[model samples]
Target: MKVTIERTALAKALGHVQSVVERRNTIPILSNVLLQADGGALILTATDLDIEISEEAPADVAGKGATTVSALTLFEIVKRLPDGAQVRLELSSEEGRLQVSSGRSQFALAVLPEDDFPSLSTDDLETRFSMPTSDLRRLLGKARFAMSQEETRYYLNGVYLHAHTDDDAPALRAAATDGHRLARIDAPLPDGASAMPGVIVPRKAIAELGRLLEDAEENVEIAVSSAKIRFGFGAGYLTSKLIDGSFPDYERVIPKGNANVLRVETKDFAQAVDRVSTVSADRTRSVKLALESDRLRLAVNNPEAGSALEELSVDYGGDPLEIGFNARYLLDVAQQIDGETGTFKLADPSSPTVILDEEDERALYVLMPLRV
Candidate 1:
């Protein structure tokens, strides 16, 4: 294969595809990227058996052909080249090497047969829909923070996406939880998506999708099935295998009858928590919240370290309540609140607390309290 492409365009496409290639692979071809030169563009594809990413970049094709080369190696070479440089790639079948040249620099990388590269098949993707990239980005971004990292509950290691009804209106919901905290965000359901089956998008795929969406076009096409999911941007697409497990019924954990309500300035509450938690234990990182009439006290006491206390005026008229929560978890949930006022619905110190943003009714968060 002989093709010439701009350094900037080649590097961008390589950067997108190489992210899915594992650094170490038992199968030799899995570590390489498949380069297909045809038509007026070069298609670069990389996969790790479970996930595949492919991108097309405009190129000058002198001889149309295909080959495989180390993804990281090629990416590094293209990235280091000076801006506006033209990159030329030629495959020598006799020597089994791919020659890469730019200006006065040249390198020969060992090549693998493109036929050996694995692909995640999307032949069974029965549910296909298109949604605004911004809407999809918000749904995944807001809830992905709560996805579980522990492997014991493998099913919880992804965001659960499904069609649902919010106040009798059809909506698409994304939810994730790690047992201690939960995040649920909803968006208007696109047409023809009501019959889509619920699916758990693995954490790694969620992260990759998030990065890709940053440079994606205004709309993104999505296709889903029982076992896999695909996201198609205007220039390229990503296909990933779905987690083969059932996510828990998360709605049960959300409390609906919490009577205690506390409305505090989001920034003030977050800052006060950050200040008091400075002396908290590293393991627990617990911060205590003592609430009364209209005042809230934040405190952290560690015998080895020191004690810290801060007070903030809040809008609360419920009975006085004291609750302890992980400082880091509190900050994470608070960061998701886009409004100036963050409302907390609490029943007791032992029960879960519901956190909401005053301006966004479509987003909800639940935090499990810790014993102080």
Candidate 2:
């Protein structure tokens, strides 16, 4: 295959496709990206058996052909070329390699047969929804951090997406938990989605999708099936295998009916916890929060080291209560709070407490208490 594509344009497309390509592969062809030149455009495809990404860019084509070249090698060559330069890629059948040329630099990459490359099947999708890139990015960022890495409970390794029927209407719900803390966000459902199936989107897919959606405000089309899910942006298409295991019924873990409420400034609470937890050892980073009347004090005790106590004023009318929580979990939830002040609903010192966004009733967070 012979094609001439701009350096900047080719680099952008390669950056997207190469991320899906595995660094090491037992099969030789899996390390290369399949390049097809036809109809004034160049199509690049890369996959790792479970997930696949395809991107297209405008290019000048002299001959209609297809070939496969190492994705990493090709990307490195494009990235090093002169800015705004045109890159020419040609197939050398006699030498059994592909030649890449841009201005003064050149490389002959090993070529593989296009027939050996595997392609993802395009099955019919049941539910389709269109969402802005900004909204999708926000939803993923709010919940993805809480996803678990443990493999014993395979379902908790991804974010659970479904529609909630709380009242007379349906709302879109996205949640992630690792048994320590949970994050859940609710958004207004789109017009086409009245009913949606619960699906567990794997961690890798969520990470890749976030990278693709960065700095893009255009609309993205999403479709789902029993086995797979697909995302189609204007420039590329992404498909991945859904987790086969069923996610647990997460509603029961979310605490409710906690009357003891305390509203404190998010920035203030986060700073206090960060300061108090410094003396604690690495393995034990627990901080105790003592609430009394209108004053909130954060204290951390370490037998080998020292103890720290800091105070912050909060608005609370309930009785004085003391609770201990992991310093790391408190900072993560506080960082995600969009509003200035956050309300923490507590029933007792041992039970899991609920946290709500004072400005937004839709977003909810539950952090499990710890024994200090």
Candidate 3:
């Protein structure tokens, strides 16, 4: 393969796909990126068995062919080349090396046969739909932080995406939880997505997809099946294998009868929690909330460390109640609240608390109390 491409364009495309290639691989070909040069463009693809990413970049093709080379090495070479310089890639079959040159710099990388590269099939993706990129971003971004990192509950390690009806209007929802906290976000459902099956998008794929969305344009095309999911941007696409497990019925955990309500400024609450938690014990990082009338007291006490206390005026008329929570968890949920005021509905110190964003009613969060 002989192809000439602009350095910036080549680097951008490589940055998208090379992330899927594992740094270390038992199969040598899996560590390399497959480069196919043809039709006035260069297609770069990389995979790590479970996920595959491919992108096309405009190029000047002198001779059309394909080969595989170390993804990391090629990316590094292209990144260091002089700005605005054109990069040329040529494969020497006799020497089994790929020649890379830019201006005055030249390097030769060992090549693998393109036939050895594995491909993730998307033929079975029966459900197809399109949504605005911003809507898709909000659906995944708001709930991803709650995804479980523990492997024991394999199904909880990713976000649960499915179709739902919110107040008789079709909506798409994303939910994630790690048993301690849960986040549920809703967006208007796109056309022809009502029959789409609920799927658990693995954590690794979510991270990669988030990065790709940063460069994506106005709309994103999505395709789903029982076993896999695909996201197609303008010039690139990502295909990932779905978690082969069932997510728990998350709605059961959400409390619907919480009576005590406390409305506090999101910024003040988060900052107060951060201040008090400074002296909290490292193991628990617990912060106690004592609410009465319109006054809220935040406190943290640690025998080895010191104690911290802060007070904030809130909008509350419920009877006096005290609750304990992990300071870190509180801060995480606070970051998701986009509005100035966050409404907290509480039943008791032992029950889950529901937090809502005053500006965006479509977003909701639930936090479990700690035994402080």
Task: Give the per-residue lDDT of model 3 (tens digit) for 1-372.
Answer: 899999999999999999988898889999999999999999999999999999999999999999999999999999888889999999998889999998889999999899988999899999999999999899899999999999999999999999996468789999999999999999999998898999999999999989999999899999999999999998989999999999999899999999999999999999999999999998899999999999999998898998889999999999899999999999999999999999999999999999999999999999999998
TM-score for each model: 0.98, 0.95, 0.98
Per-residue C-alpha lDDT of model 1 across residues 1-372, encoded as one tens digit per residue: 899999999999999999998898888898899999999999999998888999999999999999999999999989999999999999988889999999999999999888877788899999999999999999999999999999999999999999996468788999999999999999999987888999999999999999899999999999999899999998899999999999999999999999999999999899988888889999999999999999999999899999999999999999999999999999999999999999999999999999999999999999999999
Candidate 3, superposed: residue stretches over 4 Å from native: none
**Residue 38, model 3, lDDT:** 97
Residue pairs in candidate 2 whose N, alpha carbon or C atoms collide under 3 angstroms: none
CA-lDDT, candidates in order: 0.94, 0.87, 0.94
Candidate 2, which ten residues in sequence have the lowest lDDT sum? 188-197
- At residue 17, what lDDT does model 3 achieve? 95
Q: Each model's number of backbone clashes?
A: 0, 0, 0
Candidate 2 lDDT at 335 equals: 86
> Model 3, poorest ten-residue lDDT window?
165-174
